[model samples]
Target: MDYAGLDYRNIRFPVDRPLTESERAARYKQESYSNASPMDFLSVIKLNSNSIDLVDRWYPIKGFNTWFGICVVLVSMGALAGIYSALFFSNRTAPIETVDWIGVSALTPLFLLLTLGGWWLIRTECGRFTHYPMRLSRKTRQVHFFRQNGTVLTVPWDSLFLTLGESKSPLSGTTYDLRAHVLDDDDETVRDSFSLGYPSPLGNAESIDKFWAFLQPYMEAEDGVEKTWHHLKENTGYLVPVDNRREGWRWSIARSFMLGAHWPYLQLLFSPFLGLNALGRMLAMSTSKIPQWPADVERESQPEVNDPYVLTWRDNGSLGWWELYWPLICTVVGVGAFVGVIAWVVSGLWR
Candidate 1:
């Protein structure tokens, strides 16, 4: 049941309802699944109100509090400390301009940039529950897209691809990862075919197989000639070297250096830097559930749009908000801390 309350604050979604069935059918017959149905694009909000307790995010199976709770505390503490320092101390090197104060001033731009950008992005997540939809359909291998706790998509049969075979997992006997890709191109160059998460029954190979059978029809030859697909090798849990630079050797060098140069920036893009993890997480999570069905994906097709059901929902948690407030928060903290340094410096300079 849906909670009645709705929250409009910090919501962002742009939807153009699919044209009426008759209209869509006349426009594009092959792609149209239902003459009566149209693509219903919407953003749902949940809040605690007299009507109902509002919508909270959902994580399949089980999960806990978002980073917002912890982040707020950390931010508050940091802000408080900076305030204390700014009001009390001074710097030794620069008596006239306290180093602490100047340093805090330096962080202002970064925070402002992050906050405004983040607030703008919140609505695009486009769902009611915080947790992603975690499930597998017994009848159809279609991927379930949930928004406001309702199924928004029945992954087009042609969009899903499954690799069915014997693959042993560390714990589960044998498993198949229900792989799917969107039929369309992705927004970024890095991922032409984005991955949706794994189904609920990720642990058991049998369940994975059931998922495979349903998604199997969507499996088309990724290309006319054989090449390495991103989701291969993992199906058997065996390491087979592929001819691609995205993973393995070249990727390591790029990832290593990029991380070293900008780790702090990268750290903020995910949920709490990987805070809460679950047991059998792969089985429970969607990304973990689908193993890339190994196809001969040519390196030339580095960014290939092989399928259409690519799950590309992104949740940066409160980082966007955090980033927004970061500059302000950091400024407040820095200013507070800087003031302390200035005080110490001025006192000494005068003395």
Candidate 2:
């Protein structure tokens, strides 16, 4: 089933049966790794003493790249149609042969496939919220997830069956996402399931474990958020502000390609693809609406006046000259390169 933008795949834990040996092994506790911090808290929207609001994990790169590929395919298809028109429909051209019809017949499926792909991408990516956010309210002892269909799923925090989830795709190998299963009245059947953070690559279990460890105390601790979890609160390095508003061009380029790569050489290495990726991401974001929490959720999650633990993207700090200028320069060069390459391809197809 598809929830938000993610497809639930390879759900190993049986919804109806008791946990098997392997499934039991995958189950982990909040106390699994003490003093651990979240690996993908980039989704964190608002963090305060009582609650933490987070956007659902989104695959910006994948969505942007897929849309880009579709654009190129559409352009190529247009060029092919033009070529066919010149050969068969123009009076100045030689008589169309039976072989030409056969060629068009053979290519029909490919054209249809490309059209279907473009349609599907547009259908999925457009007219949706930029993200689905979830709120973890320590005071309420409940979790509220914003569903894509405009419904909210509320469950008690302690009752959630938090476990390691594995999903495999040919493009991306076995990746892990932290998921919570909501049990039915029987307490064994999984009433529903949803992922918490972004998926991680294999061998990153330690980081995920620590993230879980960090969250447990943040909720369970009786002291003020500052007194008990000040250090953990400061760890908002992964927080990138792309969800609530239109991201700046430099940020789009920086976030779309070569994330966390500070070295100039690495930036230059990824520069060529950065421009188009930024454009793609921008296009996707423009079409999507920003998500908002329900009124009741807003009421519960609101922080106390003058609360010190409240955190936002501003805490991540401003970008440097090189960080800003280099991406802008690279984006210009990359867009020029992309145009040149597409021009060459279209010209060759025309001939």
In terms of lDDT, the best-performing candidate is 2
- Candidate 1 per-residue lDDT, tens place, 136-243, comes to 232232334433323244454434332222234343344333323233333111111111323322334344333333222222223311211122211211121111
- Model 2 misplacement above 4 A: 1-21, 35-41, 59-66, 90-93, 199-203, 227-229, 232-234, 242-246, 258-263
Worst 10 residues of 1 by lDDT: 46-55
RMSD after Cα superposition, model 1 = 20.0
Candidate 2, 119-143: lDDT as tens digits: 6655454556666778889889899
TM-score for candidate 1, please give it: 0.28
Error of 2 at 143 (Å): 1.0
Most accurate candidate by TM-score: 2
Count of clashes in candidate 1: 48
The deviation in Å at residue 116 for candidate 1 is: 8.4
- What TM-score would candidate 2 get against the native? 0.83
